[model samples]
Target: MARTTDGNPERLAYNDRVDRLRRKEYRMLKGTTYLDHAGTTLPATSLVTQFSHSLQTLLLANPHSASASAPNTSHRIVEETRLKVLKLFNASPEHFDIVFVANATAGIKLVLEAFSGHDEGFDYYYHRNAHTSLVGVREHAASSHCFASDAEVEQWLQDEHSFSGDANTDRPTLFAYPAQSNMNGRRLPLSWPAALRSTSQRLRTYSLLDVAALVSTSPLDLSDHAAAPDFTVMSFYKMFGFPNLGALIVRKSAAHVFDQRRYFGGGTTEMITCIGTQWVAKKEKRLTDRLEDGTGATHSILALHCAIDVHDMLYGGFSEISKHTGWLAKTLYERLASLKHANGRPVCQIYKDPAATYGDALTQGATVTFNISSSDGAWISSWKVGQLASSKNIHIRTGSLCNPAGMACALGLSSSDVQRAYASGFRCGQEADIREGIPFGMVRASFGAMSTLEDVSIFAKFVQDHFVGKGLLNVDDNDEKRVKSEEMRRSEQSSTPSFEKPGLRLRPVRQQFWAKFGACIPFRSRRPDVVSAH
Candidate 1:
């Protein structure tokens, strides 16, 4: 990888190199157009090969072993991987502790469980645009609220006393928001967490930054730990495309709070008695030792370690990948936003923040979510778009994308309307695509390090050929059938030449995100983590 220069030719050359990398490491993507990076990045060939090689060579045992003779190889890999992760975010080990988990949702659950141990029950304030996982935390809070607008959050930041009454001053407060909207690829204010932490609030406040979306394409700089969020959660698979791992990056200053969590598992305990005495001791010496419940995912952790190296080698870190994907997204956005039916009606409804998300490198990542409209001005179901996409060998995400608040806000659907949806039997993953002429979901295509301009073009063409002016008349293809190999792809291409036109112009509509709160939530109280008397 050569130094990135501010020249078009260099960028083109870099993109060519990426194409070559795709040819070598991502042959699995040969016959298909993969646009579902948000669901999971396509695993690279070298990642699997290297991971297998490492497993064959290393004798990694469980991190905790009763036998003194067994080596702590697993522990070593976990710690090294932690340090590498810290460095990835410009965080210092001294300032932050990494706790590996199954995935991002698992990390959020860990935080909620830890916060539940507070003596005075924690107060949870979330932005309305948070993911469904973040929404679950309110179930454990003493009180919960959703901030519907930035004005509401600004008001809270300016006057924390406005939120916390004198009677509830001692309760710990957890403010959670996603760094980017998983639903619409809307990059939110990275400045909010720092703002929340520095506020003059009577309650003990902590910020939970969900970077599961942001870290996939952009860098999260924690160089100034004090200015960073208190707890950051992410899935390693989002960035590395392998190992299906996640981490909770806890500010070391806030490390004591998690120690209070009441639950303790096998490896988390230093000592415990089940037969004779009612006593237990937790391994509180190190952060990882205290939090990871069972035997750690040793093999996955090794793959995670390899993934870090592989990503750097393949894409030259997230900075370069950011620019690469951003350009593609912007190009796609412009084209999609320009699409129109023959009757002069717009063909797509794109949900985004035009000022903040599009081309604002600091505020946006590479994701686009939109819904198509028929030539007759009727809304097309995202489910139809998704089905057509699959039949055309284009992989995309459809539906609400697990952001209920964002979906409600985007569609202007009230609580009663949501209830009506349920009344109409609109269950998750069901064919409740549209009801009463209202759409329930939008199509989403996220770009990754390996995603090229061709992927975006193919998706745009798919939308144009099947949608635009033609309604459901072109549904003759084998639904969900794939051209598995290059030979099959060539045979299909030679047999049926695509008459698909290439164009996309998603209707530009601004939307705010990364905040979800309710007026008054009757939150529950859970047992707090055990506090140390020493």
Candidate 2:
């Protein structure tokens, strides 16, 4: 039996399971502490071993081969992998079909291509907090809206506001949003798809969910097909960290939306006449065959199978993995939240949902994003922090995170201000951050099922050893707090919620989680005179 860190049934089999997983399968993490699981988890040796064994013993070839001697297992493997992916998500094969793609971005493009085939191009609506992949879809829409808040989206769904031309006309519509924010691990409402379907019957709406980040730790429950999104996309590499493959899960009920896709590729067609007048007859039997443009990634798909076996063998199930990673996220959040300077200033600024708690699987994932600060409240360069952390062999992710809207929202950046900065010499990967004082990016420390308590402690200590106590301040005290311009101040006011903003929900960090850990990671001699901005 795996031991629990908190001596609770909910956290059972997590600590001991991952501790063993690290020593046996993940020997690469022995010397270094990797906290960038949000970017990609470390691929385990067992996964590679199983995959290598299959490659050495078996003959696999392209499924599209016309030769009779070409192994028949490739087709079987492709079909089995689809079933495996569907089984992992708890989606019924009767109602759902998986289409393999290069990555999540490619899946998104396929859906957009399908939507563009309509008589009138589809209207696109996406959450402002979405990843750049979702944000880029606006270019293909007949009309689009970047909804700033849930309230605005709900109102739009109510038919009170409309972005498409002639609201009365039945123009096809698609709403894209991430299951969890890639910038931070804030889990958005999973109920949005069912809610979109309940709106006025005069229009048609489809939901495109990007679950690339969500499935990293938790299982996506598609048990209720009626409530699931029309189309969902995710990368397998984000989950098991190998092969670099992704899939698009299409609800058969909503598969009609894809009939508009005009282009068909090699294996997708039944008959093609290029000599005479060009006429194409596509394979209409399966949605997967219709959209998958070229030969499938057979070896990568087999690797996914091996990954699933190793994942199941080690963590037991996604539920257990979820519980393990969630606890680590909450614990790490608490530790980073506890860090402070000698003069009572916080060492980090964590960005999270005020209404959501960390330990809850529904509200938050196993990722935490924030920027570091000086003792005098000056913004520390997030990229600089990443470099220093890398020096200590504590790997982490930093920068805009390919989330421009979330970056703008969190960093109090206005459209004009960011534009002006870019108009100047400011650019991505530049040493100088935005403006004269604003941070160039934010920092992220994410957890995986293989992550142990030692990794978290090492990371927290890395932040403490470098940023806490004395001699860390480089900027003048007067220049610490930068004066926000009028536009920037207004953006910040709208971006941040009021304390009394009705939904002020919080979860208490379990006492056992802290008391048990306090003995291992020691605090500095000088206690913080003031509280952190929790």
Candidate 3:
């Protein structure tokens, strides 16, 4: 049984039950402790089995057949998966059009391409800490603006407020922002979409939400709001499953703007044409099939279907999963706050406001960001911690994590300042040259459906052991035997005869190989004449 910091046995046993269930539920990778669910998650065993079955039985069927009596089993599977995805987001079939693409980047590109012609007076806006794909979209749009906060975005959209009355509103504006940011795991308020809609209505602009991260934590319901966004994009892989599929759900009103023939060929058409001959477009079916250009990944789509089913079965539901993650996050934050180093210095500075309510805490999602402050005024990088943890079979990630702008804002540093500090040997949480700006980034720990109370406890204990310079946890008799065997090997090697001896030189062979492939090659030097040199 795993005990909490207070040493309460009752609480420990309860938590242990949860952990045991999680262990039995998830097919955890052998010899590795996973904590980077934000990057990707390990799929459940059911998903794998279902994926294999579907791939073997149905994936090879031709998408387009001339036979009128052809079976639509594959199409049925696709539709079922689409319905599951719609259910996950609480969206209706008509209002939300699900177009399956390769991945998140492809989805973003398709949406941007759909709105390519309306880039006249359009100015793209995103938070300073948005995903790189959004930044890339802004660059492609060529007329983009960035804001630090919600207030700044609202202020920018106002005509009578800032920059005088010359506020340009010629083209349809698109704001590509995350529902819950991947970096630092910060969940934007529910009011954010409504707020954007309210402001954009006055400015005659549109909004496109990137809800890739938020899908795992909560069900997105866009029905009630007076002002709704034009489109939203999400990825299935980030939550739990396959990597090659993504989804884009567009508002019904904005459906007509997507050109059917923009990027053509394959299953998107009814018939091909010869030179000067007219072609037929499949207009009778739904718009989703019209936008779907090629034969979809049947196996991956089925895998996603199984993934959702597994999520529902094991985690109970999205609400229960959220509760579990929230509990873990809150416990981790509180425990990290109370932990101290050997010299009585706090290991991490927890960020949650003490006065915030439970609802307010839920708004942040299940992610904890902290700074490890050391006693000698030095600080530890999350990447370094990740490396240390990996040596003990635990896995995590560090650095700005593709949100350089957000990292800059949160740490109060300029882009150049961050670059310079990183160029120096400065770790996270260390005070640096203020003139260059604030000098550290945040380290984030995120939770998923399979993560349990024991995982959190193990992490807390690991942190404590590292601070006090102790051995790793779960080091059993096998590890001791391995260490003993390694020591014996070293002793045997020491007693063995030296390689260097009279007339028994093995150095010449090594030298020959070394000369053939020198450590450093000179780019400017001419190639040796192999025949003449030999």
Candidate 4:
């Protein structure tokens, strides 16, 4: 709930502590400042170490025989990881089934395929801002509807006239929604899910939550909410661990309803035979194996386990992490407001109410978005900011970030306009040329368990200074070298070449060389290797 004051040395000192920790935690580039935890987080040392150990063990074992020697070890690691995930979500082991998949998209597909095949004629509902994977399923489903708001959902359920009577008319419905959006970092109301559950019970429908972003932060009482929904999906990568893995938690009573067509061949089947013989499916009660149709990413799973363990220990558990992230978000929102451009305009246009407490705004999680304003010639596109941050050794992501629906809804921009803006290299609404007006995407600054208060202040100062052209915190000679090299290339291209062999032959060899090395040279480089030397 606390606010950060600009030029407050106490807050700046706190930010410095976070920066130091980040340098240690991520081995970031010197002078680089990372402010983009929402897209992904740097892996903790524990996670990296554990991941390496698992990989080494797998590599050491002989081909086609690793499982034989390390069967129990592999299973133990997976079970332990699952238990960690269970603890994070506060779900019981018996009711929750954890099946590791490639990613959130894969998990969504598996669930959609299973639920859609039932021929129950159950209506599928989702928000307009639902993830693409869920959106695709909704589009494909025979009976599906998307609601713009909570009121729309209420109206749809009340109107029996909208429903076509069928044998499974009383069957439960499926609702898909994200806990936090990747685009704007907007946290959807938790009350919405509970309300959906209540509506589902009265109307004999079911709700399935896509809690991919919320798994690391949001607190849900599974016991009380279990009956309302048949399943929930979560992703491991978004929480600062391994990539390419997700899980689906299904209730015990509704487990039988899922029809399994193995997407891949391995571990999912109990037995197999050829020549008109049959393969025995894995036990129904063992729901994890039901959906885990392929060989597991044992190493990545181990990393995920390590991440969760380290997350609990260092961040004072998920609850404390959530609190820390909220504080950081609040600090960022407040500080960014004080940033001014060279024209004496606020650099950031924050959308949320300034008076709102961190707890009020971040009840769902710590994700916030705002527009960045810059001078005419001194532009910093979101993409450019991401690139600049990366050049400074910071890791951040920018752009619509695969959430066109949310961008459209929040900014009132069409999909084509958003695409064009990115293609044209504009960062926000204020940055775009009015004559060539285009809808610009919002810049998101997200925080997580590993984020410190210092990260917020450093990033805030960077934005403020960058807009005013007072020299960014981490700009180096390399940037000037790049500009100079570009100028040289343009000059060379514009000047006519001296042709000894006069067939008007284009200088292919020279052109190729220039093209390759043109961007590599720094603008102020005394020698080409000088830039690389640093």
Candidate 5:
């Protein structure tokens, strides 16, 4: 039996089971630390196996065909998977209708397109930390508003309370926000969805919670029907690590919004005139049938069932996954935050609340975004760090990370400054264009259920050796006291927790993970604390 750090048999059995799954999993690319789980995950080994087994045993044809038994099988599978997805979110059939889409982007587009076809205009309010897909919804709105921070968002809603619109004459209003920020892994208030419905009586308020990032690490409880979002968009691949698929969950009351769909395809209509003049859409349109434009990604939908099964087997549930990954993120954050130069200047600047506790799942996810600085106080290039990490097979992400507003806030860039940079060729995926002294971006390292403490230690050791002075290993006086206190608190918290928490155990470094970086440079007794570029 594989043993945990504590040598507890129950924990050992749990780790052993996970280890077996990890060994069977073929998706883990060789020699990569894969610190970019926020981007995508490695599918479990059994996901593919289960999918193949289903293919071999069941006859699944196009779900649109009503006359054939094979189509019936396909239909049944699709419905079952839909329920599985709903159950995964703790959503009920009476409250939410699932619409299949290409991915989360497609899901958002569907809602935007349907809403934009309204005869009346709409007021759109979105968060600054929203993903690019959510940001695109502004184009479909009559008027758009943005809030840079949670405080700003709350204040805006509060100010709007006094203003009354003619409910009979005014257009509907929609609020869009990511449940969790994809850039820095900040978990926004889940209560925002229900609050919007009650925000104003004079306007029809609907909310879309983009759960693309949130579902990866934790469960989104739509079980509270009263508090659920009008629409929720998510990509399954982000959760299962394979088979790109997405869903748009529409509240039953909001299903009428999809009646505005201008175009119909394949199975979306009931009858058509012979002269291509008039068409009759299904009068009692099924929620999904109206929104799913054409033939679905059948194979991917089939794979989703297996993915959920594999996910549950591996991690028990999101709660366990959340606790484990939360521990890893806090550990990594604390280590990076505690680093300093000989002059006591922080070696890194983290773009998150410095006071976030280790086990707190409310404020953050398993993602850390930060920038390292030279002892001289000049910012080191995050792109360069990513490149170096890549050379060592430590796969991470860098640059603005597709959240322009979040990036702007983190880097203190003005709108004009961002526009100027964009005009000058600064963009996502072009991190190489970043010249030295540009003060461009921050590095991001995000973990998942699959990550281990050795991953954190290896990363810490790398930053320690390459980015700070050897003498800087000693914690400053103030930091020393803080570290001691944090340690005491962590010890107390972990002692009573039922699950085996990660990051509490120190293991031998995974030397192979850093082998390509060459032998570690000897620590000097005393040297200029400048971060070496070499």
Candidate 6:
């Protein structure tokens, strides 16, 4: 782990070192491709070991009271970890404060409950492609609206600026959106937050950016408060690959809205007493202290510090991670898009932003969602593909993936179509629904910092051999060969150098990747009858 003259580590010299660490540090990599990084990542060995050792040796007392020595020490650790979280986002202590929550869902709920006025009407706008947690915030707002596309959002913003009404202009408006879509891996425009404020000074505007997906493969900068979201939420595990904790980051400029909260909790109360027939209460003046109720996840918060250290060591920070995973995703996307049947029809139907590219970290991440089809243009069951993937130890995700609106919109399914399918006994996890030829789900393959070109190649070859070549006129002999252990070892070694190489191009990796594991295809039978409708 030494550095060269220019302060950059010589990647080639440490190739053997990384190889040894890969085998020992990441236990989850053994016998698995682990393409479900969007859902959750395998915890690092160092993180787990250090956390366990600390728990065994240290006295981690509750930070609720200051009457004892243990509690004081716990309080110190909690405060220090809070600063680290803020530093990770490039946020300053003067303008930003962090509140620990159960997860990203809890963070969103805290904002909606604290900001939304029940008596005074306010408009809540969010993208239709948002996660279920973001969509659920509509219930707390006075009025809710969903924008189908980015153009629709732009038109609504323009209309808000043109309207000439004193009453409507005075009411507050909150616009929440995802930095990247968990369903399709499409990155949205970051300039929308500033645009909302520029629409009108009369409109009390605020932005809530959901960075759950964006933080998994990229960074979210809050150094420039003018361009950053007024409130941002993300889960710590999404960034560190361990601990199930989340935080809500609030800008001091917009912290006043939290004063509207009606209730107080244990640590949030500064003074509470009853006088005669009435009760008097005073809340903590700090924004985080006022919002965080009950006791925080003390151990998880401490582990977050270690997770950050391990994250920095493994990927060298978000910029390096973005470059590494983006190339892997782009390579996977292009290869999957290029697969064709004997009749020259595309075998995969991918959903993504048209403007996104592999080199553009702002537009895309290491996630790909698509469906496989046969030569006669018949769709294959995504559930079936997922089951096949499990047999090959290739982990992936299927179904709507917790974003119903985005899933339905991506497949071009109408409201009536969804209702009809629902009435016919088709549910989210029902395997029989796939046989009915209903567009119920899609297959997703997500990459991360630990992902290599071999993982991408195996997934591509799986689709080509089992789904595409299974229904073709001619099949290669390699399609019938069983993947031997020695060949797998060769594939692993040939693709190992890319892990330490920064700014690695996709073409060279693909060339060397396919050279070793490209011919290793899944088993296929003779011409099988196509399942067209189902």
lDDT of 1 by residue, 1-534 (tens): 112223567556767888888999999899899887877887789889999999898888766674653347777787898899999999998899899999999999999988899888888888877888999898889888777766677898888765554326678888899998898787778787778777566237888989999999888899998789889999988887888999999998888778779999867887898897888998878887889898888889899999998888777789888888887777677667778778776676777654355667776678887777777766777766765666567888887788887777766566666676777656443344677877777788899889876776777777776777776334444442442232245545564432222331121122222233343221111100111000
Candidate 3 least-lDDT 10 residues: 509-518
What residue pairs are clashing in model 2? none
lDDT of 3 by residue, 39-137 (tens): 776677766776677677663455465354323666778889999988777777767778888777777888777666564634566766477767677
After superposing candidate 4, which stretches have Cα over 4 Å from the reference?
A: 1-24, 51-69, 120-122, 154-172, 199-204, 216-229, 260-264, 271-282, 340-345, 351-364, 374-381, 385-394, 415-436, 468-534
Clashing pairs in 5: none
lDDT of each: 0.75, 0.76, 0.59, 0.56, 0.71, 0.71
In model 2, state the lDDT of residue 176: 93
Candidate 2 stretches greater than 4 Å from native: 1-13, 69-71, 160-170, 471-532
Q: Which candidate would rank higher by lDDT, 4 or 5?
A: 5
Question: What are the per-model numbers of colliding residue pairs?
Answer: 26, 0, 1, 9, 0, 1
* TM accuracy, model 3: 0.76
Candidate 6 Cα misplacement greater than 4 A, ranges: 1-21, 161-170, 273-280, 471-534
Ranking by TM-score: 1, 2, 6, 5, 3, 4
Write down the lDDT that model 5 would get: 0.71
Query: Model 4 has how many clashing residue pairs?
Result: 9
Per-candidate TM-score against the hidden true structure: 0.87, 0.86, 0.76, 0.73, 0.82, 0.83
Error of 4 at 246 (Å): 2.0
**In candidate 2, residue 182 scores what lDDT?**
86
Q: Which candidate ranks first by TM-score, i.e. highest? A: 1
Q: Model 6: per-residue lDDT, tens digit, 99-216?
A: 9998898999888877664358566788866888888787766666667677767887677643222325456778899998898788899898877777556258789999998899
Better of 1 and 6 by lDDT: 1
Better of 3 and 5 by TM-score: 5
Taking all chains together, the TM-score of candidate 1 against the true structure is: 0.87
